[model samples]
Target: MSFVAPWFLVALLLVPAAAAVYVWWERRRTRGAEPWATAPLMPSVTRGGSRRHRHVAPAIYLLAAAVLIVALARPQHDVTKKIEQATVMLVTDRSGSMRSADLKPNRMEAVKAAASSFLDQVPAQIRVGALAFNQKTKLLASPTTDRARVKNALNTLTGAGSTATGDALAAALAIVRPQGAAGVQTPAAVVLLSDGANVRGRDPIALARRAGRLKVPVYTIALGTDEGTLTSKRANGTTKTERVPPDREAMRQIADASGGTTSDAPTTEALQAVYKRLGSAVAEQPGKDQLTSLPVGIALVLLVVGAGVSLRLTGRIV
Candidate 1:
């Protein structure tokens, strides 16, 4: 907790001062007792109950005063708050290799499920966009707060052509970047999921460097196992098996160049976990919350209780 006006806490000193005054008055009253003619015959006049009980009302009043003083200082505390506004571009690989059945039903279906779950977990205030890439890149959905639209786009994804990772990143950046002459930058991020190495389109490393210059992080997720394979048809009326494993090193390099993180997900569950972590990173921010009202409310309740106890116990309210 922090205080906006810390000097107001100095008022707390009055509580101890009042306590001292009450003690002194009580002592004086005891010392100044009037003399009695038949002192031995007179019954003792001291209060018979516990002496500590007499000070309850005064103690409550002092505590209320201290609380109110602290409230006047305008205390604050650090709190975890969701991001008010942000843009997230989801770039997914729709290359033929994504059809591999290594991850459950298929890589593409697994990716879609994990991505949908990620979208659901994202805060409503964040705007999300979708882009699918193969031999070419296409924007499936523009940035918007309507998550249903993004999910709809994800459902329409299909695997075909070759991996165009660079073009996909560029398209994602174009969608997330602000459009104006002033070129004002907003808080934005990109999440790329791929199951194969780049085989077509522009240079992914160059695109990552450009994204870094624009201060946009491009988190990369490599989704596949080393033993993954894809069956392809040859021109001579025959089929051949091709190894299509996730290029983790390339993805890591791209992420590093763009000032982002990289992860490898061999299964759908691991992919979803990675997405959940990324959602937390992009959807929430650190903030401070003012707690002055809390203390003030507590002080008000204490004041009422103190007055009620004083009136019930003693004949007058403190």
Candidate 2:
């Protein structure tokens, strides 16, 4: 917490000073009464019950005074608030390797389900975009709050061609944080999910560095397991199988270069969980909120309660 007018806090010293004065007056009055009332008659002369109870209302009033003094200082505090105009780009690999059946139905179908779950978890105000990449990159949807369009793009995606991770990241960065454009765009992020290595695209590490320069983080998810494999027909009237393990080291490099996080989603459930966590992580930013009204409200409540207690105990409110 910080205060706009910190000098106003000096007034807080008066509360304790007032308490000291009240204590001195009570002691002096008790000494004067002792000259007239004997020890046996002192109990009758003074109010019944514990004498400490008589200080309750005054203590509450002093507390109220301190709170009001703090309120006058106009305190402010940092708060985590949702960035309504924030945008997130979902860059997914639609390369042939995604057809590997290691995770449930297949890696592609699992990614779609997890992406849908991500969309559902994100705030309504946050716009989401989609991109599908293979040997070539294609923009399925630009960042928009309309979930249906993004989901439609996801549903229409089919795995083919070679993995082009770098090209996809470049495309997403262009949409969210274009080069040499204007003052400042709203907070933007890219979520990249891919299986297998980057084989036929621009250098992914270089692209991730560019993303970092633009202050746009790229959260990378390496999907699929080591045991994953894909079987396809060769050009020569024969069938061949190849290992399609996710390149976790490359994914980590991309994330580290872009100042983002790297996640390994070996299973469909893990992928969905990672997406859900990112949904909450990207939607908010730290902001400052004034807390003046809070202290003021507390002071008012304290004053009212103190006055009621004072009247009930002493037949007068001070």
Candidate 3:
């Protein structure tokens, strides 16, 4: 618990002071009272009522004052809440290298399965977008809460052409940037799944720096093994084998530049684990909640109880 106006707590000293004054006055009035003659002859004179019950109302009143004083301080508590309005841009590399038979049936198929599972795990309220990049980058789906649309876009992705990692990042950033109401940017994240290094378009590192300036972290997942190979079809209909190993160094650099983390997923299971972790990371948001109303409500209840008890016991409300 914390207080916004902590200085208001100084008023709490008045409660104890009021109690002390009541005690002193009661003692003084008792000392100055006339003594009844033959008081020892009557048992009721010495045992009129329970002393504990006599002080209950006063104690309650004092507690009520203390509670009210605390409420004036504007107490607050830390709370972790789900970010319902946050946007997550899924940037996938559909370059020809993603067809390498390094993970399961193929890198692209494994990624699509893992990505779909990730979508299912994330909160339904969180807006998700998808972008596919190869020799060129294009927005497959704009950010929206329609899970069906995002999933459909992922299913339509086909691996072909060269890698354009920089263009993909730029496109994802554009989709995740601040929009609508007051131009205030919502909390956002980018999940980039790639298997090979950039071979065309702009430099990925430069675009990563831009994303960093915009405060958008790009989590990079390098998927594939060092022995990964791809079979390419030539113009003459001949097939040629080519090495398409995972570009861990390039992915790590991009993640670092954009204030994000990089993970190496050499297997389909590892890729799913990465997506699950990202789902949790992107869901929770930390904030402070004022607790003044709680203390205020407690004080009101105490005041009512004190008044009722005083009237029932003393024939007058305090």
Provide the overall lDDT of each model, using Cα atoms, as 2-decimal numbers.
Answer: 0.86, 0.90, 0.86
Q: Comparing candidate 1 with candidate 3, which one achieves the higher TM-score?
A: 3
TM of each candidate vs. truth:
0.64, 0.67, 0.65
lDDT of 3 by residue, 1-318 (tens): 889999999998899899999889756654444265354533334323354566788899999999999999999999997887898999999988888888998888998899888898889889899999998998899998888888888988878889989989988887788442237777888999899889888899998988887777899999999999998788999999988898999999999999889999999899999998888877765678999899899999999999888787765775
List per-candidate RMSD values in Å. Answer: 7.1, 6.0, 5.7
Residue pairs in steric clash, candidate 3?
Answer: none
Least well predicted 10-residue stretch by lDDT in candidate 1: 41-50
Sorted on lDDT, best first, the list reads 2, 1, 3
By TM-score, the better pick of 2 and 3 is 2
Model 3 residue 129 CA deviation (Å) reads: 1.7
Tens digit of per-residue lDDT, candidate 1, span 78-104: 988777878999999999999898998
Best by TM-score: 2
Each candidate structure's count of clashing pairs: 0, 0, 0
Candidate 1 clash pair list: none
Q: How close is candidate 1 to the true structure, as a TM-score?
A: 0.64
* TM-score computed on alpha carbons, candidate 3: 0.65
